[model samples]
Every structure is written in structure tokens, then in C-alpha cells.
Target: MEQTANKQTRLSQRVRSIQPSGIRRFFDLASKMDNVISLGVGEPDFVTPWNVREASISSLERGMTAYTANAGLLELRVAISDYMNNRFQVDYNPDNEVLVTVGASEAIDLGMRSIINPGDEVIIVEPTFVSYAPLVSMAGGVPVAVGTTAASHFEVLPEDIEAAITDKTKAIMICYPNNPTGATISRAKLEQIATIVKTHDLIVFSDEIYAELSYEKDHVCFSSLPAMKEQTIVINGFSKAFAMTGWRLGFVLAPPDLLDAMLKIHQYSLMCAPTMAQYGALEAMRNGMEDIEKMTLSYQQRRNFFVKTAKEIGLPCHKPDGAFYAFPSIAHTGWTSEEFAEKLLIEERVAVVPGSVFGKGGEGHIRCSYATSLVNLEEALKRIGRFLEAHDIRGN
Candidate 1:
């Protein structure tokens, strides 16, 4: 027993230090329950467009199962390059500047591992995705969180980012059309952040996976800003907007040198993204704009109804500008986020992610995804309303 314990203790400290994802914990709990209405996972409810699906089926029928180059298929890379340039005004050289990965999740991990050295610090904007900080820590980097509040509509201000930087700070990771909070930064605000990056001489990992879903304004590609392309590593994928989450396809656009380093790590860990999924993504780039428009419109309508309903039920929600989540203040319920989520799950059969799980400044809130059907949203809202009434928290 002593020897077995010693062997287990020899595992990497880095792997042992991080906790399992808070979002996944609640998602699992919700999955085990009967008649649970889950707003915990941030996945779109729509299926992949039939055209894109058919492309993957055609690829399989044609026996295109063999791996392409270690980087990715040339045709897929070219398609992604053209898509980015045409849609976002960002140009990437398909031959050297783009790398397709297993998913945007892999791209994020690869970017950190390629850039970070032991003990380096990465500044993470909080009330964002759960994966950012853990991926940084796994890369032997320290994660310094800069919190964004609902009061500021969860925008990561330039000053806050500046304050978080230290001599050891190597990179800043940003996610816009943000998760959980659903906040987005304006073009002018992003330009201010770009200036800060230039002044600090730091690299940026911009996760624009939700870029196409922005309702009110076009998502300004961070790399498109003046002199920013070389310093910014843009990560995006087909999971959200194209409703291709199960396809597990994502890509990174970066300078050749950075792309080379990321490719080295990716080639070893993930030889290439799934061949069929790559084919699907290729089709999406070539012919899925109409599908994206339709999905975005549906999400916009859902966002409007969900936010309005939450406010009516006495939850002060910060209306999300992008993404399909509604971050509502649950402080008035006089319960911790976890407690509130637990009680709601048990009593009302509704599952929302506890805000505290998304790091600092996430306390006193709960993240409710509006990606499900309007019928589901209505039922969940009714259940939530009853829960609040039981607690004597009437709508204002």
C-alpha cells in the first residue's frame, strides 16, 4: 500500500493541482436527472447543416480516410484562409500561417504550450471560458486573472489588463462574444487593448470562436487591427456558428514562426484534425453562410426572450450582446451560486452553471444558456420563477 501510494504521488504536480471543470460537474449532474432542463453546457442545439454533413459523408464514401499532411489538408487550409479573409478582413497564408487542430480546444492548448515557458505568467480575462486558465497551468504557466464585472457589461478594460501585467507576464488570453457572460468589446475598445499589447510587448491569444454570432455589431478581428497581426494568434472553429461541435474541427491563424512552433507540438500530440471533419469544415467555408445567418437569427430571438424573462422573474440579467448565454445576478436570492444551482436543480429540474465556477467576479451570478428550443426556455423559466417565489424573491 505504501509503495502504491508513493507511485501515485509521483504524478505531475501540474496535473494534480487543477480541479475538474465546474461546468462539466453540473452538466453531468443534470444529465443524470429526469426531465432536467439544462442551460449549463454552451453548445448550440442545432444540427450541422445537411450540406456540410453530406460533404463529410461523400468524403467517407470516397475513402478519403487517410491522413493528409501533418499540418492539415491543403484544400481545407485554403478554404479556411479564404473564409477568414472574405468574412473578417483577415488574411492568412494557407501554406504556412494556418494550422488545423482537433478542435479549438486543442488550438488553445497548443498556442499556450508553444509559447509558454516554466513559471511564465498568462493574464486571463475572467467570466470567460473555464478552459483558458487550466490550459495555461498545464503548460507550466501561471494564470493571472483580470476580472470583468456585470456592471461594466463584463468587458475587459485596458486598464485592468495593464494592471495585471508583470515582468513575468508572457501572454494575454482573450475570449470575446464571451462565454458565460456573453460580453463583447467594441472595435474602439479592442484597439485600446491592442495598444496596451504593443506597449507591453506581449503576445495575445484571441479566441474568436463566437465571432459570427455577434448580434448587434460585426466582430472586429483582433489581428486585423494596425500592426497587430504578427502579435496576435487568432483561434476559431466551426463548433459554434456552424453547429459542428461534434465534428471537432478548429484552426489557428498566426505568424509563420508561431505557427511553426504550434505545428511542432500539434504534429506530435494530434497528427491532424479528423479527416472527415476537415471535409465538413471545407464545405462549411465554401457554402454555409446562409446556415450561419439562420442560426444567428434564431439565437438572437432566444436571447431577447430569455433575458426579458429573467428580468421579469426578478433576476437582474446583463443582456448579452453576443453568444447564447444570459448572466443574471442571483445575489438577491441570499444563496451562494453553487447553493442556488443545487436547489434549483433539485427542486425545479433546471440546471444552470454557477457563476463562481468561471473564476473571480463571477460570484453572485448564474450563467443560463439560451441555445435550446424556445419551448424548453419557456418551461425552464417557469420552473425558475416558481423557485424564486418559494424563496420570497418577487420580481421587481
Candidate 2:
């Protein structure tokens, strides 16, 4: 009898090295339980706006099911270019510089694969996104995490970024209006960071999927900074800002050479983004500004209510300037972030993501997304209050 090959050994070492997402683990756990109030997932509670949905349906009616160009539909690319120019004062040649992707997630993967050589180090600002480091690792690059704390509202400092740079440092990945923490960087600070990147002669991958969601101030697009456009790869999509997560449409804006490299990877792997989604995204960019405003206002309202209620319940939460999350410190409970989250899920039926999963400096915090309905938010907050009181975890 022939000896069976070891299945574990057959798998790639890189695939085995990374663990499954911690956020998905909690989300899946909560999904299996009855009456569980989940604040774990970062998805919008709102559905795609009727106009945008209609556009996709219309495309289907027109029998527009064929594959688009490998670089995506030219019209959609034009719309994206126009949107960026009009809204953020950034310009890109749609034909050569923009590539529509499966999602912002795919754009990130492509960006890393395109630029990262073996052993190259990419600086990731964390407690930000979970996928950044793993993607870097998968691309044969090293992920160097630069942490930010709640005391500073989770801001990524220029000095910290500079300190982490080395001869191998090739790129820096930044997600502003950050996930989990909802922290945004100021233009002054970003300019400083831009200067550092230029001085170090490094590239930047700017994930601005949440750019349209800023509540307190206008978001500064990194690529718009003087002399920064050539060095920056901007990743964005219809998911977060337009409430089109299910559409799986995103785009990347970069210089022609870099875009050409990324497009080669995209063509071989994805071919193109969904054709119907492209039509829908075109409508969103052309006619969906009001829809974005409506959603942002709703998120801001929910954010305000959630932050206020969390503080009242003895959870010290920083008021988020953007996005739909409140990063509240659970330190007073005398529990690790995972411990508090797990116990709260079991005892209170309210599910939150452990802060530790977001990398270093995330301990003693729990990420609670305010993207659910007001009624759900209210019930979740009340249950959290009850759990804190029972554990005698009043704020210090």
C-alpha cells in the first residue's frame, strides 16, 4: 500500500502560520446563540440605497453580465476619478492609474503583493485593521506594527513611525478613521507623516474606505498632500461609505507602473470586479452624495448615543470622530480583553470583539460597533450596564 502524504505538511507554511480572524470567531459564536446582541462585526446596518440597487437591477435587465476589462469598466473608473477630484481635490488618470478591485480588501492584497519583496518590512499602524499584517506576511514581507494607545485617542505618531523604520522598511500602511478605534489623523499630522515618508523614500498604502464617514472634520486624503501622490497608493471602495458592502466593489489609485503590476496580479486572480456592481458603483458616485450624507448623519447619531451610554455605564469610551465604533476601556473589570468579552457574551448575551486581537496597545479595551439600530444599541448597552454592575466594574 502506498503511504499517504501528510496533509498538514502539504499545506503551505505561510498559510499555516496565520490564525483565523478573531473578529470572525466572536461573530460566528454570537450567530449561533439565541437572542445575542452583536456589536462585533463592522458592517453597516443600513441596506444599499434604493437608487444604487436599482442601477444593478437595471444592468441585469440589460443583460450586462459579461466580464469587464481586466482593469474594470472605464466609465466606473472615470466616475471614481471624478469623485476623488471633486471631493478630495486629488487627480488620477482613470485609464492608467485606477484599477477597480474585488473590494478594498483585495486592493490591499494586490498592493502588498505588488510592492513587497521578500523580507521587506511594511509598517502597519495598529489597533487598526486585522488583515494588514497577515497580508504582508503572506506576501513574503515582514509586518512591523507601530501601536497607538487609548490615552492618545489611538493616533499614529510620526515619530513612532520613523522609529520603526529600517533599511528593509519599504512601505507604511495607514487606515484612518480607523477601525475599532474610530480615530482620525489631522492634516497637520498627516503632512508631518508625509514628510517623513518622503525623507525615508518609502511608499505608503493609504486605506481610506471610511473617508466619507468622518463626523467632526473633513478627512485629509494622503495622496492629495503636495508631492505625496506619486508615493501613495490609495485604496477605497463602495462598501463602508455607500453602504454597499455586499457588492464587493473597490478600487485602487496609484502611479501607472505600480498599478500595472497590481493589475497583472488582479487579472490573473480576479479577472475583473463584478460587472453589475460596477454599474451600481457608477450610479453611487454620480448620484449618491445625498445617500452618503444621510448614512453619515445616522452613524453620528448612533455614535453619540452609544458613547454617552457607555460612559454612563462606567465604561470609559473615547468619542469617535468617525466610523461606527467606540473603543471603550474594559480595564476596570480586572479582566483581559478576551476574558471580559467572552464573559460578557456568556453572561449578558452581548458580543464585542476583544481589543487584544487588534495587535499591541489594544489590551484592556473592547471594540463595540455602533452600526446597528438604535433599539439594538439600547438593549446592548443596558445588558452591558447590568454586566458591569454585577462585576462591580464601575469606572475609576
Task: Provide backbone clash counts, one per model.
Answer: 0, 0
In model 1, which range of ten residues has the least summed lDDT? 387-396
- lDDT over C-alpha atoms for residue 351 of model 2: 96
User: Lowest-scoring 10 consecutive residues by lDDT in candidate 2?
Assistant: 1-10
lDDT values of the candidates? 0.92, 0.93
The per-residue C-alpha lDDT of model 1 at residue 51 equals: 96
In model 1, the Cα lDDT at residue 144 comes to 95
Backbone steric clashes in candidate 1, count: 0
What's the TM-score of each model vs. the native? Answer: 0.98, 0.98
Candidate 2 lDDT tens digits, 53-168: 99999999999999999999999999999999999999999999999999999999999999999999999999978899999999999999999987788888899999999999
Clashing residue pairs in candidate 2 are: none
Off by over 4 Å in 1: 1-4
For 1-396, candidate 1 gives per-residue lDDT tens digits of 999989879988898889899988888888889999998868999989999999999999999999988889999999999998998898999999999988899999999999999999999999878899999999999999999987789998899999988999999999999988899989988999999999989999999999999998889999999999999999999999999999898999999999999999998887888999898899999999999999999999999999889889877897898988999998877889999999999999999999999997788899999999999999999999989989887545
